[model samples]
Target: MQYKPLIMGILNVTPDSFSDGGQYCVQAEALAHAQRMVLEGADIIDIGGESTRPGSDPVSEGEQLARVIPVIQALRCHLPSNLLLSIDTTRSAVAEAAIVAGANVVNDVSAGTDDPRMFSVAARAGVPLVLMHMQGRPKNMQDNPGYRDVVEEVLTFLVERAEAAKDSGIRPENIIIDPGIGFGKRKEDNLRLIADLRRFVATGYKVLLGASRKKFMGAICGETRPVELMGATIATTVLGVSAGVSMFRVHDVKPNRQAADVTAAVLRT
Candidate 1:
């Protein structure tokens, strides 16, 4: 069987996220958006309550739980039983609460570094954990982001984090690594990662590529608005597919789905 990359639709239930923030803060709106993504062929729905964009202030744990739990609960009740739900959080407490509420995966951008307990939470839950590579905290990651050989540095960081997760009792099979495109990368760095994505894939862990409407697209295409970067996002999706990525985290699900399907078909030929 030809391997088809999975699509993880983004659901940001925060008022300050870089893209589509306040738009889905309401529980009903978030659920509705999730249902739409499911219909659009999303294999997973990633719910994030805090804004991780550069220079963003952190939200309290109480606020993060309040914002995401209700939506996860609602989606669990309304969506199919097999629809994978992923909680995008850096805090262990939030990840625990979300898993209890019905999330099956943890997408931590900090790769278990933000909160020491994050790895333990994933281990206890025995669920898939996405450990992404970011240069620094969201507040300062973009401040003159420097990387010596971006691809090598990111691959090294991901390997180290994956080993740490396994050492923390997280099953090796549950591990996924993401070369975070915009978290703390320059436009050239982002381009280099995408161009050299096969290196991350060769590490033998499932690789996730999240180039969805990021600032690099704006820097390259002169599309400042996040919404205006969908074309660029789709273009990167095609590149990622060719690079053997196992999944894509995207804001616009339908278009990316089509692109991934077509790319997968072409690659098969």
Candidate 2:
């Protein structure tokens, strides 16, 4: 059977996210945007409360719960049951609350390093967990990001994190690994990771690519605004599908869906 990558739409309820910040901060607006993504073929809607953009400060756990819980609850009631909802946060408390409120997945950018209880929370809920490889905290991740071999280091980090998640009682099948595209990577580092995505895919776990509308794309295409990088993002999506990525976390769903479907068709043929 040919594998078609799943598209996970990004819905950030934060007011300071590098892209689409404050656009869906309101509960009604967030729900409407999520519905639109679902109609556009998003298999999962990832709702993030805190801004993890470079140099961005972390939102407190209480604020994160306030920002994301209502949105998750509303989504569960309104969205189709088959469509999954992911809680994008590093705090175990926030992950736990979002799960109870109806999110089916936990996406931790810190990969359970920042919060000692994160793995346990995901295990307790028995939900799929996305562990990402970020070099440092978002506050300073981009300050001096350096790597001897970006692809090797990230792959090692992700494999180790996956092992940690399994040891913490998270089912191996329920774990997904993300390369953390712009979280702490140089432009070249981001390119290398995408180019070498097969290495990550070969780890025998699901691989997620989250390179949608990042600063590095803008750097590559000479576009300053995040929204203008959709074309660049689509290119990466095509590459990801060819590289056997299991999923894509993207801001624009429809175009990526079309791209992935076409890529999968070609691969099948």
lDDT of all predictions: 0.94, 0.94
For model 1, how big is the CA root-mean-square deviation? 0.8
User: Clash totals for all models, in order?
Assistant: 0, 0
lDDT of 2 by residue, 1-269 (tens): 65878999999999999989999998999999999999999999999999999999988999999999999999999999988999999999999999999999999999999998999999989999999999889999999999999999999999999999999999999999999999889999999999999999999999999999999889878899999899999999999999999999999999999999999999998
The TM-score obtained by model 2 is: 0.99
lDDT score, residue 163, model 1? 97
Error of 1 at 9 (Å): 0.4
